[model samples]
Target: PDMRAAEDAGARNAQLTKPPGALGRLEEVAIWYASWRGDPRPRIERPQVVVFAGNHGVTARGVSAFPAEVTAQMVGNFRAGGAAINQLAQAAGARMDVVALDLDRPTADFTEEPAMSEDEVVAALAAGWQAVDPEADLLVAGEMGIGNTTSAAALAAALFGGAGGDWVGRGTGVDDAGLARKAAVVDEGLALHPQAKDDPLEALRRLGGRELAAMAGALAAARAHRIPALLDGFICTAAAAVLEKASPGALDHCLAGHLSAEGAHGRLLQALGKAPLLDLGLRLGEGSGAALAMQVLKGALACHSGMSTFAEAGVSGG
Candidate 1:
């Protein structure tokens, strides 16, 4: 992020219709977009929501209420424009794309084996990078892997230096017992691949789902393309954690779209130094939070660029 643009935006905001700091986080939103874009009057258009769908072998542990096949099923639903993210994207006026990562190879159970090899992770990342259009104004990366929360929690624990159990969450409406089982599985996976604790890419290779790897890759590509990224919930944050580790300050191009209801999500966002745009107790991770926040960003950009200046409105100035 560019400090000069933010300072310039702050100066510009003070000259707008409202008093200084009256807009609160909306002002911050404008500043952030400006900082990323190096444009005091930044505008967002051509918003795209990319859903990365993959299967998680850990679902065999009965962690999630939905089965692994549901990952593929939801991809179909996303194509049909019937999923929650689809509806949210429609409301937000954003285009949505779904990518199925590693459909040929079955997902490895991280508790027993690496979730994806280095080659697989690299390939998935490349696919994610290619998915982002250079013309995209903003990119929102979402995940649809069953049991991905477990993979995400494991990645968080690995990068953040915590017990896997501490980062685990009930994904897809897992019950108390299912949550416990998910924690145990993540712990065991971490134990099996302990090197992930010190290496971020290693963590993704060992514990991250295909969707997560792709998410991380897409974020890296966004930074390269200078497009701001709006991240979803727990899963998205965890992937961002890995991206941050791989490339320092990578998340400077990203916005924490919302604070998920999952307990670990706050920790991940705090680690990433991001303040979410919305806090609606949203736990759904299919990029729904990001899509909704895109709407808020649109509002913020509109107010920042459209509101008349004090001089233009013939009003008093500070």
Candidate 2:
């Protein structure tokens, strides 16, 4: 049952095939999973993507070119069966769940914005957990919220340990002026939540959007259920990084979907010691990248399970 033994078996299987490297990265991914699982055969079952939606506080400061109302509009779009996430999920044939999390809104009608209580955060997370099948083999978490990039940037800055400003990036099209304002907002938010200076949960409460906090909870639940989780884009990866810090070994089930244009996303991947499957300069959120990556994963698993080794195929190789 040793992974090394399984890898040896997989390599022999590849050698038996008619062409070398014909399968490209698929061959490598199959063998890697084989070794990781300690089995010649590995299967990815019950792939699901959870898209968490919420509102962010920084949007009130015009951090993004789009209006804050877009968050609710996009949510409705997702519910009505349109949007990039819907297309990507359909393409990947993954079950998609869209959850609406009621967090502090940048556009809330109040003299003072109310901070989300731990109980509300936990309850939202619990609902997210219930939305998916506990037996899913792979889970992908996506986020939808105006100004979430600002929230994610703030979380990344606080968690940067030493590299804060270097990791922050513009979300949803911001000009130079907007970027500066965004960074300042993140800096201020981090200062306001000193208790979360190094704490993930406190950071979530302080700088995280409802979608992000729920995404964290969903990831924790996925880990508890023993399912591999795929991270999509900047916000999702940032959320995963927070959850990882909170629970060591939680990232064992995580797969980096792609290298993102967001600066903080790159830093988070480096911190996590993960290599992304793709790098198309993708800046769009909604699990589009992760859903596309799942197709390659399916191909890899199919090759591992269906292909014959050189000996079995009666192919000759020097």
Candidate 3:
């Protein structure tokens, strides 16, 4: 981040017509965005939303209510602009891209073995990194993969030293029995892949699905290019957590877009110290929540850049 730009934006915010802190977190959001964009008064001209889809072998363990085929079907829906993310992104004036990663070959069932080998994980990460647009000022990453919430839970438990029951949630509207089975599957994967607990990237490879790994890579790319990111729900947050665990402060350029209905999502956000911008009971995996939050960011920038200063408006005691 550009410290000079941040200071400039903060000074401008103080001079705005609004009373101090009247805008609340929106003021902070604008300044943070300015720092990443290297412009004291930045405008969100082009926001990009990427949704990566992959199938998970863990679905074979009945971890999710939906079938693995839904991953591919949803990818088709995304391409046809029929998914919720497509509508949200369109409303936000964002360009949307959907990448499906080897849907025909799902990851190995994590309960029985590592989800992905080193080469496979690397390839998935590269796909994510390459999917990012260099010209995009803002980025939002989403995911589509059946049983991926189990992968996310295992990854979180491995990274943060928690039990499976602590991180597991009822993904895809699974029943109580299915939820318990998901928890057991998570514990089994953790027990089988003990080495992942010591290595963050290894945890992603062993316990995360391709779309999750891709989301991690996309966020890393956003950080590298100095583009601010809006993080989605549990699966997306779990992916972002891998980057943070590998390198502290890796998520400094990112913001939690919203709080999802997923049981463990709030706990994960608390762990990351990210206060979400919205809480609409959203649990949809498509970048719908983040895309919706893009409008909030746009509103912040609009007010920050378009509002006149007290001096310009010839007002006193602004």
Candidate 4:
């Protein structure tokens, strides 16, 4: 972050027409954005939303209420502009891209063995890294994959030191029996991949899916380019968590976009020390929550860059 730009933006905020601290978090949002953007007054002219889809072999365990085919089907929905993320991204004037990562070849079931080999995981990461647009001012990475929530829970538990029951949730509306099965699967994976606790990247390779790895890659690329990102729900946050666990402060450029209805999402955010921008009970991942939160960013930037200072308006200084 550019401390000089942040200082300038903070000073400008005090000079704005409104009373000091009137805008609350919006003021802080603008200043934070300015620091990353290196612009005392910045506008989000090019926001990009990339949704990556992949199939997870763990679906064979009946972890999700939906079948694995839904992953590919949803990618079609995204391309047709019929998904919730498409609408939200359009509403925010964000350029949307959907990448299907070898939908036919899902990751191995982590409960039985490592989810992906080193080569496969690296390929998935490369797909995500290449999907990012360096010119984009902001980024939101979303995922679509059957049983991915299971993968996410496993990754979270591995990186954060938790048991299966602590991280498992009813992903895709799984019933009680299915949820129990999912928890068992997570515990089994944890036992099989004990080394994941010490190596965050290994946790991703051993327990995460292609789409999850891709989200990690995309966020890393965003950080490299100094593009601020809005993180989505449990699955997305779990992917970002791996990056942070691997390298402290990896998520300094990201904001929690929302708190999802998923039971473990708030816990994950708390662990990451992120205060979400919204709480809309959203669990429909595909970057929908983050895309909606982008409007809040736009409003903040608008107020920061468009509003006149009291002096500029010839108003009396308070």
Candidate 5:
């Protein structure tokens, strides 16, 4: 991807916009993708949002403020176009797809059982990839799972070579005492899961739910086809990071949506060498933050296409 072309396009358009950098990160996003795609005249075509829902085993340890059933409830809300993510996706002119994998949903038959099998994970990922257009310009990966923060922390610790404490945080307003308990749960889960102690894919197999695995597969598919993706918060980014490690250059197609309230997000983004676009202190998953970031990308694409260069606009140069 030739980012230079996008930058040049952005610079050329600045004179045409009302004020320089007025759009802020929005301008940067458009230019970034333009350069990445080597298209000075970039367009954001058929943006898609994928929300993956699953249940987590670690939630049994009282890690999250919300119950596991909330996962399925939110999925139903998303399908009904009622969640915040749904609103954002609609506002951003994006098509939405909801994926419900039988990872560990509260009402699921295996709610109290272990994670999915390796074959089940592969199938989920395949479905996630199919949820979007193969030629779409961008992909957004969001998650809906109770106690997913625990899974994300463990996965980040394993993939980025850190401890669970490094990635674990007060998810959904867990107090200091709760944080300690969450960390302990993460530590124990990490110790017990063989995948968490070994290869990233194998680790995902052991600890990851349907949503995370599917996001990983979606990310991999996007990269294989040269399409860029936007990662929403900790869990989504963590899954994306796993996918990146699984296949080199996978991160090339991803943009860190924002700095999540989750503690592990920073270190995970750092490991990927990505700078987030927003810092709204968002902790609620379900792709809300990432959907907001899409607005910025849209503005950037507008700048690329709508803005005129100095020569074209007949503007005087200093």
Candidate 6:
């Protein structure tokens, strides 16, 4: 957000040993850090991953491959440090915390009722923002919920209206029949809450999950704290869309970790005006993409700070 520091980084880049713009997006990533941090040698020493796990009432509609119980099970797994995000966080050397906002007791089905009450949404968001570690140098928000993609698609379709197939995806590797079911659920929810298309907070309360609201709250807090946040795949991105709708430019405090294989992820990224750091065809949630992308940021910082300039290397400019 600091253009002055970014300009200074650009000038420093031009004087580096490599030709200008040779490092590609890694250069841009380094500049992104330099711009916000004003650190000539910025580093992510205290990266953290905060995971919000919950259950969706829409799972009763037969949307995902996994049962809704898996939501609570996985939350237990996260608590025991046994989930994929746990391993990924350990590998990334980031502290991991799992917050169970609404576990086994699902929120009300959005097709039949609101996902959460206004008070619940407010409390979820407050919990999410409060989860952020002020001592952290970087933060990543991840979600774990069965049938969350359906909720994400419904929210995305309402915001960026289109056919159900355009926004829906095969969450948890659902088959054709399950995919159709998921799409139908989204279509039904969108039809039920057409007015939420114009109102973001309403959409979160209507179609989004408590975990999503928490993630959005974390995004807003990161923006307020000037801490760079890494966003996960579809569900996380949809949560970000909520924040962007509620407060414009809230996503400016975050970076997209990856372009997920989900149908609506790219469109959601476009809506947020963010280019993902990686595109490994990832659709697995649980903060895996965020964990993997942190390596890229560390790499960028290492190169930008460790490499010698042309003058220091005694190399003549061409």
Per-model TM-score, in order, reads: 0.96, 0.87, 0.99, 0.99, 0.88, 0.96
CA-lDDT, candidates in order: 0.88, 0.74, 0.94, 0.94, 0.77, 0.87
Please give the lDDT score at residue 228 for candidate 5: 72
Better candidate by lDDT, 1 or 2: 1
Which consecutive 10 residues in model 5 have the weakest lDDT in total?
105-114
Give candidate 6's TM-score.
0.96
Task: Flag clash pairs in model 1.
Answer: none
**Pairs in steric clash, model 3:** none
Q: List, residue by residue over 285-305, the lDDT tens digit for candidate 4.
A: 999999999999999999999
> Which residue pairs collide, candidate 6?
none
Model 3: per-residue Cα lDDT over 10-116, one tens digit each: 99999999899999999999999999999999999899999999999999998888888999999999999999999999999999999999999999998888899
Candidate 3: which stretches are off by over 4 Å?
none
Worst 10 residues of 4 by lDDT: 54-63
Q: Give the count of colliding residue pairs in each prediction.
A: 0, 2, 0, 0, 3, 0
RMSD of 6: 1.4
Once model 2 is optimally superposed onto the true structure by TM-score, how far is the C-alpha of residue 214 displaced, in angstroms?
1.6
CA displacement after TM-score superposition, residue 6 of candidate 1 (Å): 3.1
Q: lDDT of candidate 1 vs native?
A: 0.88
- Quick one: how many clashes does candidate 3 have? 0
Please give the distance, in angstroms, between residue 180's alpha carbon in candidate 6 and its true position after superposition.
1.2
- Candidate 4 structure, TM-score to reference: 0.99
Model 5 agreement with the true structure over 97-155: per-residue lDDT tens digits? 89888744332212233366767778878877877678677789888988888877877
